[model samples]
Target: MKTVQVNIVTPDGPVYEADVEMVSVRAESGELGILAGHVPMVAPLKIGAVRLKHSGSTELVAVSGGFVEVRPEKVTILAQAAETSAKVDVDRAKSAKQRAEEHLNHPNESDVRRAELALKRALNRLNVAGK
Candidate 1:
């Protein structure tokens, strides 16, 4: 089976770099899967979990928002913030989710967008961490 080199990067540092049998992520339009020999393209990614399959194991990573560049032999993810399942703090994420929920419930347009983004990020982390 052929594989593609996948590198996930964030402002902090590189999250993961490995050869993956397959990669799936949520694009702005919809979910997309990348495989080796895929045509080159770039797409904006949404806040969600990125699934990476290699060998017989699958890994999930949470991305706040970013872009994915796919080439024939490689896939690169540039995320605003990214965290692996092990790196996610469930308690912290839960707290953030609660705060965002509270803020979103209020009728304030200025903070609503930020709160919504926070909620999405927290939920994405929780989902990826299997919490």
Candidate 2:
């Protein structure tokens, strides 16, 4: 089986690095699937789950927002924030989602846009965590 190197980097550190059979992510335009020998490209990522497939195993990572750069043999993700499924705190995400939702529902236009973004990020994390 063919594999490509995938690295996911965050501000804190490198969150994930592996040689995987395939990677799928939600780009700003639409869904993207990358495999070995894919043409070089770049895309803006959205707040959603990143799916990696390798050797009969599948891993899920939640990304708040990011950019993906794909080379012939490598796929690099520079994310604002990312968390693996195991590392995601479901309870915390739930609480955050509730808080953001409340903020969005209120008439505080000053922070409403920020709150909407927070809600999306929280929901993305929860979805990736299987909550």
Candidate 3:
């Protein structure tokens, strides 16, 4: 099977790097799927899960918005924040989700947007973690 090198990175550092058979992610425009020898392009990503397929299995990564750069032989995800399922802290994610929900329920108006984003991120993490 053909494979392409995929690198998921954040300002802090790289989160994942490996050769994958396919990469699926949520872009700002919509969902996208990339395979080896894919056309080169760049797209902004939304806060969601990035699904990596390789070796007949799939791995998941939670991303808090960013951009993906795709090439014929490689793909790079430059995210503001990212965490693999194995790295996600379930407790923390749940706590964040709770806090965000509380803020939304009693929205200060100013914090509404931030809280919404936080809720999305927390949900993404929990989803990726399968919890």
Candidate 4:
């Protein structure tokens, strides 16, 4: 089976590095599925799960948003924040979701947008964590 090198990096450091059969991610335009010899391109990523397929199994990585650079044999995700499913703090995500929801209910104009983005990030994390 052919594989592509995938690296997920954040400001702090690299989060994941592996050779996988395929990679799927939610881009700003839409969801994209990439194979070993995918065409080179760059796209803005959304706050969502990055699904990696390898050895007939799928792994998930949650990303807060950033950009993905693709090459024929490599994919690099430079995210603002990212966490593996096992590394997600479910309790913290839930709390953040709740807070965002509360803020949304009575948000000031400026805070409304920020709160909405926060809510989206929280929801993405929880979803990726399978909560």
Q: What is the TM-score of each candidate against the true structure?
A: 0.97, 0.97, 0.99, 0.98
The TM-score that candidate 3 achieves is 0.99
> Which sections of candidate 3 miss by over 4 Å?
none
Q: By TM-score, how accurate is candidate 4?
A: 0.98
Report clash pairs, candidate 3. Answer: none
Identify the runs in model 1 with alpha carbons over 4 angstroms from their true place: none
Which predicted model would earn the best TM-score?
3
**For residues 1-131, what per-residue lDDT tens digits would candidate 3 score against the true structure?**
89999999999999999999999999999999999999999999999999999999999999999999999999999999999999999999999999999999999979999999999999999999999
In model 1, the Cα lDDT at residue 68 comes to 99
Worst 10 contiguous positions by lDDT, candidate 4: 120-129
User: Against the correct fold, how does model 2 do in TM-score?
Assistant: 0.97
Local error of candidate 1 at residue 128 (angstroms):
0.4
Candidate 4 residue-wise lDDT, 14-93, digit = tens? 99999999999999999999999999999999889999999999999999999999999999999999999999999999
Q: What is candidate 2's local distance difference test score?
A: 0.95
For residues 1-131, what per-residue lDDT tens digits would candidate 1 score against the true structure?
A: 89999999998899999999999999999999999999999999999999999989999999988999999999999999999999999999999999999998884889999999999999999999999
Give per-residue lDDT, candidate 2, residue 113: 85
lDDT of 2 by residue, 5-117 (tens): 99999999999999999999999999999999999999999999999999898999999888999998999999999999999999999999999989987849789989989
